[model samples]
Target chain A: EPEVTQTPSHQVTQMGQEVILRCVPISNHLYFYWYRQILGQKVEFLVSFYNNEISEKSEIFDDQFSVERPDGSNFTLKIRSTKLEDSAMYFCASSKKTETQYFGPGTRLLVL
Target chain B: AQRVTQPEKLLSVFKGAPVELKCNYSYSGSPELFWYVQYSRQRLQLLLRHISRESIKGFTADLNKGETSFHLKKPFAQEEDSAMYYCAFRSYNTDKLIFGTGTRLQVFP
Candidate 1:
């Protein structure tokens, strides 16, 4: 079965540095989303995207976060500056319609 | 306040035993409920959704709107069924999932 794929399975960056996490959702899915789980915490939604624009976002997705579909097959999340609290495993998901979503292996981001 | 609650952090059972994972939600609008499983080294995968009203892998869940709950159940558990299960809730037009912390099921032989 075709699944979502993400790059840099693990990432480590210094605090205050910028990092871009990449994902390639299932080729035919129209809706894409980004969610993160801090260690031992519930997975929290960051943002949802469709038609090259953000559909909805959470409070945690503040000024530092941005998402882009720079190409037909790629969806990317960029964090302008990292903080210690930013360390978490970020998952990318997509769906053909809306509710049921498929998830990627996830990129574990560790901000030092 | 939209939230999904899986009260139990861990549930253990033996082979051939019955299993039930509890889940409750708080949402003003109608809620779409789903169960996602993540095995030891695997990514989260859909187990089943309440709307389907079908059983998968001998497991089934019923959406009790009156109780505001969607609990997953299996009459006979197999060792291979061990995994982390997350109960999720979504509102129409919300497009995002509100997930419970997750329940880890350990089915032993």
Candidate 2:
């Protein structure tokens, strides 16, 4: 089965530096989303994208976060300036035409 | 706002015994529910969804709209069933998912 793929399974960065997490969603899927799970915490929604634009975003998705579909296959989340609290497991998910999303393995981000 | 809650952070059961992972949600409207599992050293993946109404790996979950719950149950736990499970809910009007704090299910043989 086709699965969502993410690059840089793990990343370590300085607190003030910028970080970009990349994901290639399942082929032919239309909607894409980003979620994060802090250690020992529930997975929280970040943002959702459709038609190359943001459809919805949670309060946690603040000024530092931005998502882009730079290409037909790549969906990237960019944190302009990272904070220690940004460290978490970031997951990328996609669904065909419905709401049932399939998630990627996730990228573990660590900011020191 | 919609929310999901998995009360038990850890649940232990012996092999051949029954298993139930409790899940509850706070949503006024009807919601679609799902249970996702991640085995040791594996990626989080979908185990089952409420709409399918099918049992998988001897596990099944009934969407109790009346109780605002979607608890996952397995008749006989197997050692291989040890994993982390997450309960998620999303409604038709929303594109994002509300995930509960995961529960680690350990089935000892």
DockQ of each: 0.92, 0.83
Instruction: Give fnat for candidates 1, 2 and onward, in order.
Output: 0.91, 0.82
Report lDDT per candidate: 0.95, 0.93
Clashes of each: 0, 0
The superposed Cα distance between candidate 1 and the true structure at residue B42, in angstroms, equals: 0.6
lDDT of 1 by residue, B2-108 (tens): 99999999999999999999999998788899999999989999999999988989999999999999999999999999999999999987899999999999999
Q: Give the per-residue lDDT digits (tens) of candidate 2, residues A3-109.
A: 99998899999999999999999998999999999988889999999998999999999999999999899999999999999999999999976757989999999
Write the residue-wise lDDT of candidate 1 on A13-110 in tens digits: 99999999999999999999999999999989999999999999999999999999998999999999999999999999999776579999999999
Runs of candidate 1 with Cα error greater than 4 angstroms are none
Q: Which digits, one per residue and each the tens of the lDDT, describe model 2 over residues B3-105?
A: 8989999999999999999999998998999999999867778899999998999999999999999999999999999999999998888878889999999
- What are the clashing pairs of model 2? none
For the predicted complex of model 2, DockQ is: 0.83
Clash pairs (backbone) in predicted model 1: none
